[model samples]
Target: MFDVCIIGGGIAGLMLAHCLPSSLSIAVLTKEDSFSSNTALAQGGIAASIGPGDHPTSHATDTLFASAGHADAERVKLLTTEGLAIIESLLSRGLPFDANQAGLPLLGREAAHSTKRILHAGGDQTGKMFLQYFLAVTDDHVKRLPYNSVLELVLRDGQCVGVCVEDGQGNRSIIQDHHIVLATGGIGQLYSQTSNSSVATGDGLSLAFHAGAVLEDLEFVQFHPTVLTLNGKSHGLISEAVRGEGAWLVNADGQRIMTGVHPLMELAPRDIVARAIEWHWQQKGPVFLDARKIQQFKSKFPSIFTNCHNLHINPGQDLIPVRPGAHFHMGGVQTDEWGATTVPRLYAIGEVASTGVHGANRLASNSLLEGLVFAKRLASKLLSIGFNFKEKEIHLAEVTKEFALPANLQVRMTKLVGILREVDKLQKFNTDFPLRWFDLQHYSSLHIKDIHRYTACSLIAKAALLRDESRGAHYRRDTPETSEQWTGKTVELSLAGYTFGERLLKYKESMS
Candidate 1:
């Protein structure tokens, strides 16, 4: 039993733990070590309006623009405004953010940002630095459980009370808690090529859904415009900050790919740039990121430099192979300003929660900021509410099959549900695979994780099929234009089904 059970060990879970009072017992459960998360893999730094000539409003405006006007105005304002304080607070705590020679924090711009407002540490190692910092400062009293996967949320009386967790050796147990927070990160591993870690298999989404929590915007999967590709496989992410430093996207024939694609060209919103590169790659063959012109490339992005070096490709001399791949999720378990989900005593933050700040597309580098701001908010709310013990009747489902992930799941998802979408493909995907939030009694913990991935992929496909118009990261080739009808509204999915405005539809498989 615990006072607070946070399901994830990333920055958001750790940040929440840090903010909570030591008087309360807190346990953070993770499938892997703390560093194995999308947060740790983040190459671009956190975004804040702290640079010269930048303001929170400007930051919010850029974020809204990147979101294609689908973002919540109030939440975005809060995210950007509070972001500055958090960065400053980290600095005051002696976080050695990369700085200019004069000791001012070095700020760099990314695609869609109006100004240079990104702060990094150790060049491209900003996320790593943050992970270390949060892990170090987190109170020792807070328990950290690695290699523990949450199989299901235990709900009673319409409120979440605990969770069914599985350990590394396949041991299972129930954790009774006053509060349960799902900070389990994104669903990128559902795709064949992604920048997310192996643990990002949509565990939080499925758990929340089964527990009757609402999920929003599952279709808005952001594909980073530049992930290093070699021999048709993703090597690693090439941060957009490279373009912010004057890198260019070129074709196999050495022609500039983004010259007339958008006014911002290589520095345009990720959705625009990714589509452009994909189109060019299809029409003119492979595409590459030309960073030869950037001075001190190795010093500015050591991680990327080392990756390229390992591949024997010199960014300063060669055209680095590049392609778009799954990068960030713009949606997940829906939450309010306080990170409280629709379910009582259950919360979500970080990439797992759809706070509606990211909207249809996430602004580059705002991800880290979202994790920090919302985790703090949720923590404060939890501290104020304090703890109350509750015991619910325990129920265990009968075990059946031990299924593994399908061999072709990733390929099918990448082809049908990825980058570009249309009605025909989406319908085909649904017809072939379908949505099945399998009966717990029919599946064991050993195979529940695999089932979750399939269900998550189906849910994403369903959401993509429902939203007919192209907007932000969700681009439908058939209905290529954005629709005013869908703007500012969300696609809310639950156990009963989902709604996009007045149309409420139920998944046929879910009913069974």
Candidate 2:
């Protein structure tokens, strides 16, 4: 038995380990190595109001504006306000944020940001730097179980008591712990073309759903505009900071794609930019990032420079091939201010938990900040509520069928539920690719993974089908305009089905 069992090794989980005192025994588990997470691939850096002339209020305003009025105002305020202190604390603990010659933190601007307040380290390797820092500083005694996949959340009497995990060599074991934290990252891998890490298969989201936790805004999937395209698939991500430095999106005729689209043009929120790129792709041929204007791209963005080098595309001359791809999920398991979910003792942080900071769309660079800030808050909350375990008999749900997820699920999801969404397509997807809670309770790890993928895709489709309006990342072509009635309303899903707002009513009844 352990005091806390964190089912991830990303920034949130590792940061929590760093924050917790050494007195408590903790276990951090991940399906792969500790560094293989969305945190390790992030390039745009963490957002905070630490730059000169930048304020938390301004940051909060930009965040809310980008969220399309769907974000919780109080929670957004907390994220921005508390985020500053967290960033500062990281700096105090020897985080080497990039600095100017004057020894001030060098701030970079990203899409939808009012000013330059994004902090990076090791050039474009902000997430990698953060992961290294967290790993180095995390408590030495914290047990790390890499290559251990969490198959199911063991529940007893409506409360999560433990987990059933599978090791790399097909070995399975049940571990009972007092508190469970899911920092299992995003649901990007559900789409065929995505910029997320391989482990982002919605494991945490599916686990929460089957364990009776509420999931909100499943439709709000953020498709980043500037993913590097290779052989008609998403190969890698080109950081938003590259465009922040004046790279323009151009079409076959060398015309600027984002011209007059929005006042910010290429710097508009991710959803708008991605839509613009996709529109260009449909009307014209291939789209490219014209980065010929940016000075010294090699030194400033070393990773991007290397990627371009490997592709044999010179940043100074050639147009870098690009397109929009699944990047982030604004919606996730619903959590309170203290990172506590509806299910008792099952806390969540990072991209897995919807703390309402991102609302309908997440502002670029806020992801890392949200993870750190919420992890800190959760640590404080956990410390206050000391550890005590009352042993309960774990009841594993009966498996109904050994479901093998369809291979074409990713391609189908991308087609029906990608950048553009509509009622007919969503309904078709729901009908053809149905997912039941019963199929999720399986003994095989591979089967469980497949169930998670299908369940997560189903959740997103159902939520998107229900919300008949264009807002933030969820743009329904049929309902191109944002509706006033849909204001403050969110589509929430669980094991029973889906519904809207503060109601346990059936989805059909809520829609009516």
CA lDDT of every candidate: 0.85, 0.86
My TM-score estimates for the predictions, one after another, are 0.92, 0.92
Q: Please report how far candidate 2 places residue 380 from its true position, in Å.
A: 2.0
The lDDT leader among the candidates is: 2
Task: Give RMSD to native, each candidate.
Answer: 5.6, 4.9
By TM-score, how accurate is candidate 2?
Answer: 0.92
Clashing pairs in 2: none
User: How many clashes (backbone N, Cα, C below 3 Å) per candidate?
Assistant: 0, 0
lDDT, model 1: 0.85
For candidate 2, write residues 4-122 as lDDT tens digits: 99999998999898889999999999999988999999877899999877888889888888888888877887888899988887788789889889767889887688999999998
lDDT of 2: 0.86
Q: Which stretches of candidate 1 lie above 4 Å from their native place?
A: 101-103, 244-248, 253-268, 282-284, 291-300, 393-395, 401-404, 501-512
Query: On residues 354-431, what C-alpha lDDT tens digit does candidate 1 reach at each position?
Result: 988887888888998999999999988988887866677686766766666667998799889989788899999989
